[model samples]
Target: MSGENGNEEESRGLKSLRQLIRILSVKSGIDEAMADDLFDFLLTVDPEKGISDEEVEQIKGYKQADVRKVFRIFYDLRIASYRRGKHPDTGATRYYWYLDSRDADLALLRRKLQVLEKLKMRLKYEKENEFYVCPKDGARYTFDYAYEYQFTCPKCGTMLVPDDNSKYVKVLEDRISRLEEEIKKDERRVFGR
Candidate 1:
């Protein structure tokens, strides 16, 4: 029974890690396959240790430039940290990467907040912009742009009318609210305060 419980807990942890990698992949704008490869590579290192860029390139079969791209993505998202090291004999520099799971969790929280901030900006734009729609074709246009056409549908030649975007604004507001709540929860979980 104890063995079964241990296995179950390990499986859950593994699943959660996979999910987090996927989220990190999306937020960092890196391909999921690349993220998975990086995650696997990171898994081979002990949490107390860091891996060199050359070692990672060899293990992942990626060239130095490709490895740099991956490293930048991880670094930008704060999923990993690196420090420069020098070869004693050759005087060459190398980057050592460290991916602590705790850091990854905090980075994910920050990424979510950034995404939510962009969404909020878009929502604000929607709330501020005036929209006009052609009743015949249901085509929409911005206020000044529509005036150039004399407020008529370009496709159907119908006069355009003011579009009531209250529902759209409300929907955006609701989405922003939900994201803010999720961010709060994520912050609480990651920060534990």
Candidate 2:
């Protein structure tokens, strides 16, 4: 039973890692296919040594430039690392890349904090602001902006109506609560706090 619980925790950690990678990759606007490729490659390799340029080039049908671009996307996310070294056989210069797991945990922690702060600010705004929505286009605007448009939709000329965003407030509140809990747990694990 204890071993099974350990496995479950390990699985949860892995799922969180994958989720973090997916979020970071999508937020970077990297193509989903290319991001999957990079993730798969890293999963198959020993992270300490990473994979060489030649190995990365083995990704079928991808242009060298495209592969490099994928690498750059990973590098930009800070979850991946790039380094150069001498080939043991040929003594030629070679480049390698790999996932930075420890750094990734820290980055995810920072992202959770940023998201928590942003959500709190947005929730406050949602609570404080009077919102108007265009009946035709579903476009939303603040009270001041809507009043400037004379309570009319500029795009479609439909009347702007008061929108009750109570559901959105609930959603934001729930998200904020869940994220705060997750961050607290992750902090305890990652920072030993």
Candidate 3:
């Protein structure tokens, strides 16, 4: 019974270890064959069954820093890492990797859609608004309000300048427009219309 239990434990451990390796490899953006080769190499070389800097470099054909960088990309994307732990002997940081069981590609798509929707709403509001500025006092106003008040600086009483150079606001408007266009493109791709 003890032997059977031990064997089962070992088998489960091996399977989980393999899964971790695959996640790390995919997150690193390596091709399937290369990632597999790298995974095998790392597993074979890890003294504590935890990947280390030196082993990562040798397996991934990168410097220690570079190999770690590939993993960091996944970190930035929030799509990898099961847990953080410290190395027992060296006290170096280690991250256990996990392939997100959820559909990561679809998640990314949904996130993009949400962003696009927000941008579209903002753009809709901006398109309805026009901006103006006072040349004398540098006061800003919306078009209709400014016109109603005769484009005069409330503080300095100077004629307000047409604020065509609201560069930052214009940039935001441009970004929103671009995002809206992208959303339309994505919709077309999805619905073929």
Per-model C-alpha RMSD: 16.7, 14.1, 18.1
lDDT of 2 by residue, 6-39 (tens): 4444456455656666676677675666667666
Estimate candidate 2's RMSD in Å. Answer: 14.1
Backbone N/Cα/C clashes per model = 0, 0, 0
Model 3 scores a C-alpha lDDT of 0.56
Candidate 2 worst ten-residue window by lDDT? 1-10
Angstrom error of the Cα, residue 152, model 3: value is: 1.8
lDDT of 3 by residue, 27-47 (tens): 666544544444344333322
What's the ranking of the predictions by lDDT, best on top? 2, 1, 3
The prediction achieving the highest TM-score against the true structure is: 2
Worst 10 residues of 3 by lDDT: 99-108
Q: Give TM per candidate.
A: 0.48, 0.52, 0.36
User: What lDDT would candidate 2 get against the real structure?
Assistant: 0.74
Model 1 stretches with alpha carbons more than 4 Å out: 1-100
Give the local distance difference test score of model 1. 0.71
Q: Which stretches of candidate 2 lie over 4 Å from their true place?
A: 1-101
